[model samples]
Target: MADTPNSPVVDAQLRRASVQERLGALEVEQARLRQELVSLSGELRLPGLYLTLDAAGTSALLVADAVQEVVRLVELEPLPGAPPHVAGTFIYRGSPAVAVDLAVLLGVTREPALDAHLVICKGARPVAVLVDRVRDLVEAPVLVEGTPDGDVALPWDGTGLMAGLCRTPEGIRPLLRISAVLVGSEET
Candidate 1:
């Protein structure tokens, strides 16, 4: 074939092949990282009861058990002008904490037990959560970016949370969006 200005098929083919090779190399790297992650996943653990609650009409995850030790529940002072979601005000760790029932707020038909523990946000002055049955200790895996569509319903818009869903030994666990649950919309 005569070499013309537009005739660069051989060069283009070579370039395409090089790009495919790089992509394959990246896939291999990803596989290695995932294997490393599986091995290392056992090492990292968060000490607390993972509470599976509902907040603002959506399911939420909260680290509850350990927080109770740090926070002290006090007598209800009463917030007369507060919203229906706001159950009452209590002193937890000498800080003002708003005790809000997770069940009612999430519109769950089942009543939330009084025995359920409270989870006060680390920095929020007057925000605390009343969780139902606190779930087992969950060790989450590293998550990757992708579309969110699965069994577990998320707090955000139908899609999943910040870190995305993690592939766990038992099943796919939805990564919790802590901030969203801590300070959910009551104004709206």
Candidate 2:
């Protein structure tokens, strides 16, 4: 719609109007893309951090968004009159949080050997879980009963701490539901 010889360049008002129109169009497109993301949410799998635990040669895993950091092992100052699962406490994030032994909680053993690693979980009720080994964190797919396809699924027998199992390259690893594990523990 150039009416003058320099309409495209000389008309500062027209240039501003053109830019505004394009910006508005781009904003609408952005909103549409966000809605598309929401619609396709079911198919998109979130990255999950899986902690592989080898408690006395038995392999297990903890799967949840609760994992904060894996710090080097340190001597735990035992909480007087605390449950056997609660090993002790230490300064985490400038505050004290209870140390939990995953093996003891799962009944694998009375206490997991404090040799190398600690999984510090962050939350309102922050606590450190003791594991024999803290394996590398991987982008775990959405955990399933068995395999992705309709096949053998590990039934929740309520004897273990995991909510379900994720079939990993190593094998099917139990996904520990941290909330459930923490619930039944004696907090007194």
Q: Pick the candidate with the highest TM-score.
A: 2
- Candidate 2 per-residue lDDT over residues 59-83, each given as its tens digit: 5666546788888777889888888
Per-model root-mean-square deviation over C-alphas: 17.5, 18.2
Give me the runs in candidate 2 sitting further than 4 Å from their true place.
1-47, 146-157, 184-186
What C-alpha lDDT does candidate 2 achieve relative to the native structure? 0.61
Candidate 2 lDDT at 96 equals 76
- Put down candidate 1 lDDT per residue, 1-188, tens digits, no spaces: 86664568867756655664564455446545644654667333333445454344444444443244423334556678776556677876576667765555545444444555566655424566665544444544434333345444444434223333444444444445444433342221
Which consecutive 10 residues in model 1 have the weakest lDDT in total?
A: 179-188
After the best TM-score superposition of candidate 1, give how far the Cα of residue 111 lies from its true spot, in angstroms: 3.4
How good is model 2 by TM-score? 0.61
Rate residue 67 of model 1 by lDDT: 47
What is the C-alpha local distance difference test score of candidate 1?
A: 0.49
